[model samples]
Target chain A: MTTSKSNFSKPLILVTNDDGIDAKGINELIKMIDSLGEILVVAPDSPRSGQSSAISSGYPLRLIPVEKKEDFTSFKTNGTPVDCIKLALNFLCDRRPDLLVSGINHGSNAGVSVVYSGTMGAAIEGAIVGIPSAGFSLCSHNPDANFSACSDIVTFTCRKLLEQGLPQSVCLNINIPASDKINGVKVCRQAHGYWTEEYDRRTDPYGKDYFWLTGQFINLEPDNEETDEWALAHNYISVVPTTYDQSAIKYIDTTRNLFSE
Target chain B: MTTSKSNFSKPLILVTNDDGIDAKGINELIKMIDSLGEILVVAPDSPRSGQSSAISSGYPLRLIPVEKKEDFTSFKTNGTPVDCIKLALNFLCDRRPDLLVSGINHGSNAGVSVVYSGTMGAAIEGAIVGIPSAGFSLCSHNPDANFSACSDIVTFTCRKLLEQGLPQSVCLNINIPASDKINGVKVCRQAHGYWTEEYDRRTDPYGKDYFWLTGQFINLEPDNEETDEWALAHNYISVVPTTYDQSAIKYIDTTRNLFSE
Candidate 1:
């Protein structure tokens, strides 16, 4: 697993995820990426899935050092994924890491799911801070997902990213399918998608009505091979180049007309 | 304020924000928008300023209906701003809202701040579900900051969005400068920016090291008048058209080359 940098200067790799430090997915990711570089595992102390790019601003945050290993140093925070990244960059890391990787997320963070993804949130934060970053996810919600199938692809993608730098402030959202055997990787765009709301109403012990939030993710163009959703559906590892800039430049003019005085 | 909808059919407007329901900013917003339509306020129980587009998926969420007025309904959720919208759309509102408005936030969410804004998160969630949505912010961070300067602009923009409709899945991030009087509104692009981290480290009574994260928002292109940051600096109400589709379409080939076997 020793690559070019591993021999001369071990690249410092900062790893994080939404599924707390104890989750099996992140441990699997740590085991694989540790071989490539000196690792720093800074992640949330609790599950923060769907936490998006949230930061714990109102209250003072604390970063507790959990463990120190030969190849890796670990810390956990009572914060969101983005918070973990900020803490790692500011207080924990000795220097800016050579690479930042998030996840092996328990569930897929493709399509519209990116908007509420804490896994991609950390990666985006890494990109924001001028670090090369990537977020990996498998298309499985189960805690004990089969990660062996995607390990090679993950290693290859991370190695490729390290070898050939990504565009400035751009990060990668790589999603692998749940199958034991995988097709080759494909570079694709995010599929246009929405989640249909289906709330399950329930009553409390005191007889007050409440609701449980759950939905169905609907891909508008599911058949399009140019999208991440389609690629993942067909068992191909999908790599979508993502940027933090959310400006829809093409629609600025149309939007301007609405606000014209 | 009740121009046409209040008489025949009141348009339902879902109102939410990152700065809890009780924040002075949201109250000011609610007071203004209440006349235009039937308002449903579903905001977080506490402040969630930098919460981005986070959702509470790990635990069972509780949506407690607090107040019900003749033309307005209010609920507080133990969730993020995005959760407020999801709950509102699923259980609170009879149908999808005609318009979704977030904030009149106590501070500016301009430039790169849009990527980490809970106010914008609610708006983006609204847009994701195919609603006309916008997030408004004032340049002041004080809880009691005078929102008087930007109230009219907020009303005008929301009114304009309601009247003319935005592009599909595209929402607006409107940042109002803190000025006694404004120069008027200008639709602008998001300024390319980054936050330089300058963390404050501290130790607890037990003498363990921890840190409090803080940073300065630095505009990479400060001199560009075409950006939201520039527009706000010059006292213009800057409206930046925002979308959730994060795909860096231009860099797809560049990224693909890296993944080639």
Candidate 2:
């Protein structure tokens, strides 16, 4: 594995989240990582839940400077999570960031949820751009969820990533189980799970129709102990090394056979 | 592998796209697949480029039935690609769809581009819902890009998928090289690649700053023969089996050791 070029005494850390610039989750994350480096916070201007890896191409993005201090600086954008990373790298940051830390997001981005996570998307984008990155999510979806219990693990994991670096093109999806007391940490694979969707149909004053999106998660492999879902359910913080490559290498041969004439 | 529960003589197929309901690409796809089964088209109301796997959670969604006929039905929604699938599966469809097909997308969804594609998101959502699914893209950005050469491959592959069910939670990402004449097909891996991003920064007359996102693709492994980018470059229709499990299993032990005390 190639060593990352993050050798400076004070690393440049880019921070972001999907829950908007003013959310409690991002604020908790800033409190944890602020002392470690020169921090630049570039995040979305409003809540962008389930944004995945979206980039806003239909409109021009505006980056508004929010705050600036000796050890910290902040900006917000009228864009998605991926757009924050792109805007920060291209226009906000004077140089490439050494570390990218996203979230302390309100909800768990474990298992299949990562695919719809704006928090994880920012960190993935950072890894794509050759930065060592990690996304932290508390398992609670409540906006006011307390993150004090997660502080120690967050610090430990972030420091380790800054020190050891990561495999090229890989980032960490760190999910902390929601609690007031700490448990241990676990390195696990993303669990096989899916959302069973239920749409609430409604009508407008003019008798036109609409729908609301709601769902429940069903864990396909409930007995599997090596999955992020299991780890989180057992009250352990789960860290899954994730890659952007979606290729199912094991299924290639069979797929080729089926498609061949 | 479990056989899908789509045992009827005629299959029920769900069609959607990221390029909005009236785009030429989706229309061509509807034309290609309309005869294979009872088809239902549910897509975004406006262009949703770079939407990835995003879902709408903050606002209520609306699915408006636009066209209904003997062989086909269509709806346009004010939501992202994934929202279209969720709404269709939950309230729109009479029963679970036998298959889900998204896009003859206006641009290529090859290599790293897949991570930012709204086209693939709908297919992934379908696979999550236990349906055989595929996302098709033509390697051209023009709205009116000719898809005549792509129709044959689209028909062949979609038929094969409907005949032989996909592995659980796995879907196909198919990209056709832009050409008048076609080469054969290739089952390939997602190529190692990244975008070299450059933001075009601009200022308004009021001196407010805004930026436009633009980038060029950089292939990391140009000589690798088993990759989607290479297949496309050589005029082969590329089919990559894509799964939602982002875990880099090979790196699990090393990651565990790093965080271990």
List residue ranges in candidate 1 displaced over 4 A: A1-8, A68-70, B1-8, B68-71
Cα deviation of B64 in candidate 2 (Å)? 0.7
How well does candidate 2 score on lDDT at residue B98? 82
Residue B162's C-alpha lDDT in candidate 2? 82
Best by TM-score: 2
TM-score of chain B of each: 0.94, 0.94
Q: Write the per-residue lDDT of candidate 2 for residues A63-94, one digit (tens) a residue.
A: 88786453477888999999998888876666
**Which candidate has the highest lDDT of all?**
2
lDDT for model 1 comes to 0.85
RMSD of 2: 4.0
Task: Report the C-alpha lDDT of model 1 over A190-212, residue by residue, as the tens digit.
Answer: 99989885566778899876666
Q: How many residue pairs clash in each candidate at the backbone level?
A: 0, 0
Q: What is the TM-score of each candidate against the true structure?
A: 0.94, 0.95
